[model samples]
Target: MLSLFLVALASASLLPGGSEVWLARQWCQEPAPLALWAVATAGNTLGSLINVALGRYARHFQGRRWFPASPQGLARGERWYRRFGEWSLLLAWAPVVGDPLTVLAGVFRLAWWRTTLWLLVAKGGRYALVLWLADAWLAPYC
Candidate 1:
């Protein structure tokens, strides 16, 4: 469970990892669907929260040489945020776009409760889907 949680957390962050594979393996071994799903959801959501914190504070470092994004990139992000608004958070479970969206949410200083609610739904729904697919594809093998 801890391994799943950690993997989910790390994968949800900017870090590079794939939690779905690990989750499927764990599901095969333990067969504890609910606990695994909940742990993965919680950990992934927490990791996204970390990105939110980084986004909240990222403006402070914009003038620094080491800041990751260029001024133009930041402006583009702001524009994207304005266009999509928080509704884009529904895609927060997507591979390439999800993590950054969380950060954008923080950069825009969106309401935390609303952000968290969206994250929980998105992340939890993702794990649920992954679990369902695992059960469908690997059930006989397991």
Candidate 2:
């Protein structure tokens, strides 16, 4: 669980780590699958929420223009949010754009609960898929 939390925290930021690798290892070691999934999901969702909070309070720093607090950027994010709604968070597991997407959701002031819920779904699905694939490809060797 601690490792999963670290992986989630790193992956949620602009870092290059992912909880999927840890998940795959845990699965290969024959740990309790459900417990691993739950912990991974919780950690990932919490990390994403931290990013959302950063976006929510970004306006306080006038010099931090790179934080996506500008009016134009916020407007564009709002348009995208309206068009795609909560499902857009499904892409939150994607690399590069994933972390920023969550931040944008906060900058746009979308419903907090909805954003968090969707983010969890997306991230959880991603971890599950990765675990499944690893098991499928590596089980033959084991």
Candidate 3:
């Protein structure tokens, strides 16, 4: 469970990891599905919160030489956030865009409760789907 939690956390952050694969493997092992899903969701949500913190403070350094994003890029991100609003957090489970979306939520100062709610739903739903698929795929062999 700790390993699952860690993997989920890292996967949701800027770090590289694959929690879905870990969860699927754990699905065939001990511990209940509910526990696994909850742990993964919680960990992923916590990881996203890290991104939110980074986004919140990162703006202070936007124009510095060390800052990653250019002025135009930051402006573009702000525009995108304004256009989509906080509701776009529902896609927080997606691969490429999800991490950035979480950061964007922080950048725009979306309500913490709402951001977390969306993250829990999306992350939990993703793990549930993974578990379902794992069960179906492994049924023949078991």
Candidate 4:
């Protein structure tokens, strides 16, 4: 449990790792899907919160080419923010665009509660879907 929690936390942070793969492997080992789900969701959500804070405070560093919000990501995130407004946060758990979206939310200074609510929903859904797919289709094979 501790390992899973740490792994999930690390994966969700600005670091590079895949929490879904970690969660799946741990679920297979311990058979505690719910616990794994909670840990992964909580960790990923917290990480995204950090991204929001970074967006809130790191605007000065945006000139750099490799800031957390890359140039392309900033443009795409801006479009999403402009087009969908706060509702675009529902994709906060997406791969290519999700992490930057969280930062964009903060850059736009969106309401914190709304951001967190949608972020939790998206991240939780992702972790749940991973477990569901594994249980429904992979279990029999394993």
Using TM-score as the measure, the top candidate is 1
Better of 1 and 4 by lDDT: 1
Residue range 1-142, candidate 1, lDDT tens digits: 9999999999989998899999999999998999999999999999999999888998888889998889999888788877776898989889899998999898877789989999999999989999999999999998
**Residue 116 miss distance in model 3 (angstroms):** 0.6
Regarding TM-score, does 1 or 4 come out ahead?
Answer: 1
Residue-by-residue lDDT tens digits, candidate 4, 1-142: 7776777666655677788888888877777788889988988888888888888888777888767777778778777777786877778777777777887788877778988898889889999999998788768665
Model 1 ranges off by over 4 Å: 62-83
Question: Any idea what lDDT model 2 has?
Answer: 0.78
Ranking by lDDT: 1, 3, 4, 2
Error of 1 at 137 (Å): 1.1
How does model 1 fare in lDDT? 0.91
Residue 7 CA displacement from its true place in model 1, Å: 0.4
Clashing pairs in 1: none
lDDT against the true structure, per candidate, is 0.91, 0.78, 0.84, 0.80
Model 2 lDDT per residue over 1-142, tens place: 7787788777886667867888878777775667788888888888888888887787466357465347776567678778885676788889888888888777667788999889889988988887678777867765
